[model samples]
Target: MSRSQRPIVAFLYDFDKTLCTTDMEDYAFIPSLGMTPAEFWPEANGFGRENRMDGILAYMYTMIRESEKRGLPFTRADLVEKGREIVLFPGVQDWFGRINAFGETQGVQVEHYVISSGLREIIEGSAISGAFKEIYASEFYYDAAGRPVWPKLTVNFTAKTQFVYRINKGVLDVSNDRDLNASMPDDSKRVPFTNMIYIGDGLSDVPCMKMMRAYGGQAIAVYQESNRSGVEDLLAKGRVDFIFPADYSEGTELDRTAKNILRRMAISDALAEENQEQLRAIGRDELPNQARLF
Candidate 1:
């Protein structure tokens, strides 16, 4: 198929647990602060609860304060350097390439994106950072001296939904709210909801998963052994379509299910296009009544 003829399918993922084994900060950032994950997370949560601050911002702030106490530099470079220590889940390192290849063979153009509450700079430092077309996450703005000063962006759970819309409209720039909110025709949008899939781990991802369910997309929850029951709850509640071990290895349930979804979306796109063509053939401008087909 020609470039324009190929249907575009998007895979949107949460970074922390969906792709990696644990929270991004647990890898190296917390350790560098001379604090364990147990201590750091609780303190951050406590601060948020006491001050009525957003949890994501509270953690970012805690990072800066703790770094200062330890005489560690909280520069963008420092945080990114910590990302080097992140350990991705099994098969994650090669998952994108294989999925992209499979999509190509299916006449689908695959695009990957990360909508996370973790630090964007840290994700940028990871080995698979370049695989995503866009990474929407919390970020800190540095001062003239290159010291972290303020939160540039904080993507809490609910805020994650906007990035889904951004991906749908191809308005990737986080700073551009005007165009993101502008009304646009469904067909004119870049990628249809039906062609999108969202993969997330837990509660922080509920809003995005719900968006996928409400809209025509598919949502998958990947879980670790410790969180299997929580993930089961999500599936039982019909909040997600499927749950799999946080493994992306070839032949794994996740890998197979993802491919199946891609194929289904590809077939749906083809059918919708053929229906439109049939309408145009008969010189009818009225929208085809076959919306139920796709």
Candidate 2:
């Protein structure tokens, strides 16, 4: 289908456990500090426990402190380079293209997005980073010397929900245009919530998953096969539209489910458009009668 005629279907994903099997930092960054995941997490958690700090903030602080102690460079570029080593789940590299191709066949435009609490710089280093139209994730600020200075943006569970609205209103930048978020009518938004599909795992994604589902979007709560019990729990609670194994293989449950969703959304959009055109034609036909009275 031509670009002008394509119906938009947005696939919003949570990183960490959703896309990658493990947390991105645990894959490379923590190990690069010469500490095991267990060791680093305990210390980080201890600090959070002692200070009553947010877990995400504590982790960021731990990264900076530990990197400094290990004499590892803590620059933005260094973080991005570490991200390059982050491993993805099975079939992830081809998942985007496959989904996009399916969308094309269904006359829809499949757009991907990342709404992650993970560091943005590192995600940018990932092989599949180019697949997303926009990434809403935590990021650090740099000093005049271009060194990582501080966390400029920290996307926690609730904060990540804001990006959902931004996506709806076509507001890409996090730093500007407050009115876009505050005053834009729902009808004027770029993509309706019903056109969205959110994929996530675990508790950090609960708020986002709930928000999407509440707003007419579908949410999938994915879990490893070994963790079928958790999937059952989520399904019972109605927290997700569906539950699927974390497996991303082509023709797997995930792949087939997503394809079916796109097809359904395309049919809905086509029907809506047909109705609109019929209304216009009716109005045109009635114009002659109204003009005769005038």
Candidate 3:
């Protein structure tokens, strides 16, 4: 189907804590290197401090450095293998289908996306990878030997918001920044900001959360018991529209809220479409004297 034809509602997610309990790397890859999270992070952070490198790049570099020292093959395939072992939070496995079916009932197409700073290979290896229309995340470039050698892309907090615009413009290709930056009328856009829903964890999500508020989109913050205080502060400050537990189980608060948001967006879109049709249907004879559409 053409991009303009479908009334699309996008659910953009932050993968790590929002979709799963902990960071994806912490789940399997770090342990594979025989260093605890505590030992590994400080070393990675120290390397960043010493080199003045970006934190995301520092971590990506650390992944390659540690893998080589351990004599482990650091290919895209290797990270994906580690991804398979990563555990997900409650009911995440079934969440997408349930949400998609709910969207169908609302007469809108629900498109899922992952906009993360995590490794793309790891995310690609994830069990839930198939759920997303696109995964915008950090990725490594392969050498001639097809081994991951350098960071091809690193999507930090600020970088993530660009993908949101890409989705809005229907310019899915990451290389196409020209069209994304081009000024298009609100009505010409593929997905209106009001039709987008961003789901993220905590601090790092602030940029996109604020973006949603500035635009017409909605942002939802999900948290665990340990991070409930942080999420509450976000709510108190009005950085996000709502906060819910990361639970995606059937009929849970998160699921229910998502459905309601979808319902509202669908109704809003349908009303807008009806108004547009009526305006287009108005004849030259009916313009000034008599009102045909009431």
Candidate 4:
């Protein structure tokens, strides 16, 4: 089938603690700064508090300041190197391809994306970076000397929904505000909200999750064994549609759930196509049910 004929299903994920065992910084960057996560977060948060800065910007600033203070390189390459240390949940490396193939069998095109508050450079270094069509996250501007000089983008919890809208509209370029903001009918969107699925961890994911739920997409929360209670609470609060263990291993609850969602979306897409075809057959394709009076 042609690309235009295929139904597109997008799966958006949060990086830290959602796909991996812990925060991305906990793996290497913090340690390289001579700080433990426990010691580093409070300092970062305190700096944000004292300076009245956005938490994402504050942390990026802290990274630069500390790295410069210690005479560390603190370049984009340094971040990519640090990303090498991130450990992923079971079967994460293979999960994308498996899901894509499953979507093909169900007659849908599955696309993956990362909408993370973590560092884009670091995630770019990850083994699974190839899985995503786009990875939106905080990043830095490097000087001619290749040292990180400034924060280029800071993706906080509330701002994540913007990327979701971008995905829905197929406006992946972060710089194209004109296209992103232009009004488009729901049916004209490249991927309607109902065809999207957002998978994330707890609290920080609530805004995007709630947006997905409100817009007819699926919002699923995945938790670690020790963190199941938090996700359960999210489910209980009706902020998310489903909850499961973070295990991405094939046939696991999370994996099974993902496949099921894809299957259901494919069915919905097929039924909608059939409805359109029938309408065309009956000369009702124009369906003169406009709210406006001619």
lDDT winner: 1
**lDDT (Cα, tens digit) per residue for candidate 2, span 1-294:** 223766788999999878888889887888889999999989998999999988778888889899888888578887789888887888888999999999999988899999998899999999999999999988888997767778898998888888888788888788866755478755457777878999998677788789877877889978877667877788799888898888787999999999998888888777666655666768743222112110
Q: Which stretches of candidate 4 lie over 4 Å from their true place?
A: 1-4, 286-294
Native-vs-model 3 lDDT?
Answer: 0.87
User: In what order do the candidates fall by TM-score, top score first?
Assistant: 1, 4, 3, 2
lDDT digits (tens) for residues 98-180 of candidate 4: 99999999999899999999999999989999899999999998998778887888899999999999999999999999999
Residue-level lDDT of model 1, residues 167-192, one tens digit each, is 99989999999999999978778987
Q: Choose the strongest candidate by TM-score.
A: 1
Give the per-residue Cα lDDT of candidate 2 at 70: 80
Candidate 1 collision pairs: none
Estimate the Cα RMSD of every predicted model relative to the unseen true structure.
Answer: 1.6, 5.5, 4.0, 3.4
TM-score of 3: 0.93
lDDT of 4 at 210: 93
* TM-score comparison, 1 vs 2, better candidate: 1
Cα miss at 265, model 4 (Å)? 0.6
lDDT of each: 0.91, 0.83, 0.87, 0.88
Give the per-residue lDDT digits (tens) of candidate 3, residues 15-90.
9999988888998889989988898999998999999999999998998898888898677778888899778889
